[model samples]
Target: MLTPESAAKFQEFTQAAMGRQTQVLINNSVVTEPWIRTPITANRIRNYCN
Candidate 1:
């Protein structure tokens, strides 16, 4: 379900969180290690796209 807008939003949110090194949150819980990776990674997104 990673549409362009959501993908862009993810990047925007993460980029905004740069420094202080905070992880991404979903339902008030940290998901992955900041910008290193997420539950849905780019490679997986490409697979879904194809």
Candidate 2:
């Protein structure tokens, strides 16, 4: 399960990557949506991981 903090961290990483126009790689590829969108919730991250 991903906590709120973890989700926030993920959001930060994605935002940074997109802001810089860098390619964001997903280890699981299942988290693509949140990685492309902003303000991901903990539930979303948890679901992605699951």
Candidate 3:
């Protein structure tokens, strides 16, 4: 779960990057490049477990 502060920051980032291609990185390695479809305005949690 994201703290309110973190979620707000993420929302700002998404708003700025909306409709743009971005890279997902982990440990200084590029994971995947994907286009941002929309801005995430809600504080809803997302499950990244797979």
Candidate 4:
């Protein structure tokens, strides 16, 4: 589930990365380059929100 904050962050990240000429690597992988990524969980968000 994409909450408002998470959705916003993702949108912002996508926009910024798209605008940049250089590639952005997250966790040793290029974000723009497609690759399998772990699914987001409420557990991660809960720990953060609480």
Q: Which candidate is the best by lDDT?
A: 3
lDDT for model 2, on a 0 to 1 scale? 0.51
Tell me the deviation in Å of residue 24 in model 1: 5.3
Clashes of 2: 0
Candidate 3 has a TM-score of: 0.66
lDDT of each: 0.51, 0.51, 0.78, 0.48
- For TM-score, candidate 1 versus 2, the one ahead is 1
**Tens-digit lDDT track of model 3 for 1-50:** 67899889988988999999887677999767767788877787453535
Query: Regarding lDDT, does 2 or 3 come out ahead?
Result: 3
Model 2 lDDT per residue over 9-38, tens place: 866766666634333346845343333444
Which pairs, if any, clash in model 3? none
TM-score of each model, paired residue for residue: 0.40, 0.39, 0.66, 0.37
User: Candidate 2: lDDT of 14?
Assistant: 63
lDDT (Cα, tens digit) per residue for candidate 4, span 1-50: 56778866765555555534444475987655332133333322222211
Question: What digit string (tens of lDDT, one per residue) describes model 1 on residues 1-50?
Answer: 67777877766655555554555457987665434333333321332211
lDDT of candidate 3 at residue 29, scale 0 to 100:
90
